[model samples]
Target: MSTSLPSAEPTPSPSRPALRKILHIAFWGVDAQTLARDIQAHALTQPGWTERLHITAHDLPHADCLEAMQTWLTSELQTSGTRPHLSLLVPSGAAQNANAGELQLRNALISAGVSFQVLYGATSEERIRNTTNAIALTAKAILPSSERACFVVSDIAKPINPRMRSWNCEKCSDPECEHRLFTGLLPA
Candidate 1:
């Protein structure tokens, strides 16, 4: 008669919970309102894990876009009260089809001390290449098949200002620096 007892099976460990969800944002010089709407729409439309929506303004085009973004950021920052992980879609090159509005957006962001990472958008190839890694990290990467939510600031209404052309204008002045650089032109 065998006296040896059957070896006991080892207890299995519980699986770990999934990490915080991340949403991938691809900017093509889109304004903040449109971007926000797109992100919200994606959250509603896409099927998969749920994660909070956010944005990182990379090299953008247009002052208006920045302004709109600032409005969104102000709300988000106030609510969240901290820097959130985000990605920015920027033109691949200065000579590309990038708009002046996009350039203004980037410049304003830099001046405001906002931070973001650049994802190339010069060509389909480059945009694809830059986005691959970001998309992979997300639980669900989404894009509108026909109309992407991203819209250039130039497409939005501009904030009109009369003294934007004047360097001495308070609108153009920078409190942080002796020399005032054009933060961005008021919507116009």
Candidate 2:
């Protein structure tokens, strides 16, 4: 007698594929859109899924991003007449641990009662792409699909490109180096 191992996720039925709506808050602009699209496209190519990604709004601030977010939210409520329930899949590509900006964004959202979840990040080039895959993997662990959701790449996200680098991490010791801000490994 051969014992078969159980399948990880129930094999999605072809007849009834999962349908989901994704409103992308593209704080990272084209970068975020690319990541979101990659994630959604991969999901669609998988066994079962049908999704629509609508780039919802672009109001990220260079200085204070969450302030723009709050204003946008208020305006949206006023226009739509109903608060859109959001299951935000926020994928941030940052190497270091949460800093003040990141914390502030989370805190403001918490105060506003906006639902969200943040994804992990790493150093060097392709940080955004790696984070995208990581987000998809973790998300699959929770549920294969959802009824409604949002893909949010935080405005605080700094794209890492090591190709044209001038500053050396070893030579630089400034704790607040702009180079190290987004892609440096935090000290233990």
Candidate 3:
């Protein structure tokens, strides 16, 4: 009897490394530092989040917020930076407006060369509550249950002058100590 030819073994292909997962949270009319602190204090306190998840907070400009976001995304892409999933917090209003804003923002990001998937529309709320429920819900989608976090954004009244400068009595009388602006008050 003739010997049968030996069967060839199947070769396995090399597996690709998994991409790093990141979450980016952007807030309008909220201080970046406060948001970051709240997220860390409220959300990251969970167990698994300390190791697997990473998050960043940004304070969006009231005007042209989308455009600024686009620029930021473009820079990150150009620099070969990791593109994290984005979430936006906006004021509560008609669903139509929210939808429109979402589309425009999505388009802006895509045009700016973002490669990662952008999920969910804007989360809206009229006022800050004890816990930012909407943000927590959104975070839960991508992060583990323990890592979901939220924030309460309180508005601060604008000072008489928002600008900053060194105080100089020669410039004007009654220099606004906070901003160093001359309030035009007559010298007492």
Off by over 4 Å in 2: 1-31, 51-59, 63-67, 76-92, 95-101, 123-188
Give me the candidate number with maximum TM-score: 2
Best by lDDT: 2
How many clashes show up per model? Answer: 13, 0, 0
Sorted on lDDT, best first, the list reads 2, 1, 3
Question: Can you tell me which runs of candidate 1 are displaced by over 4 Å?
Answer: 1-19, 22-28, 31-82, 92-96, 134-188
Query: CA lDDT of 110 in candidate 1?
Result: 64
List candidate 3 segments past 4 Å from native: 1-29, 61-69, 76-80, 90-188
TM-score for candidate 3, residues paired by index: 0.35
Report how far residue 178 has shifted in candidate 1, in Å.
33
Q: Per-residue lDDT of 1-188 in model 3, one digit per residue for the tens?
A: 01111112223346744333344444322333444455445445443332333445443333356776566556534443455444433322333334444454456656855433222222211122212344444466766654443322233222223222233445535334523433434463
Instruction: Estimate candidate 1's RMSD in Å.
Output: 19.5
- TM-scores for candidates 1 onward, in order: 0.35, 0.39, 0.35
| Model 1 per-residue lDDT tens digits across residues 61-178 | 2346667756544553454444443445344354334566656655655655655555533344444433433443332335333222222111222223222122354444545432
**What clash count does candidate 1 reach?**
13
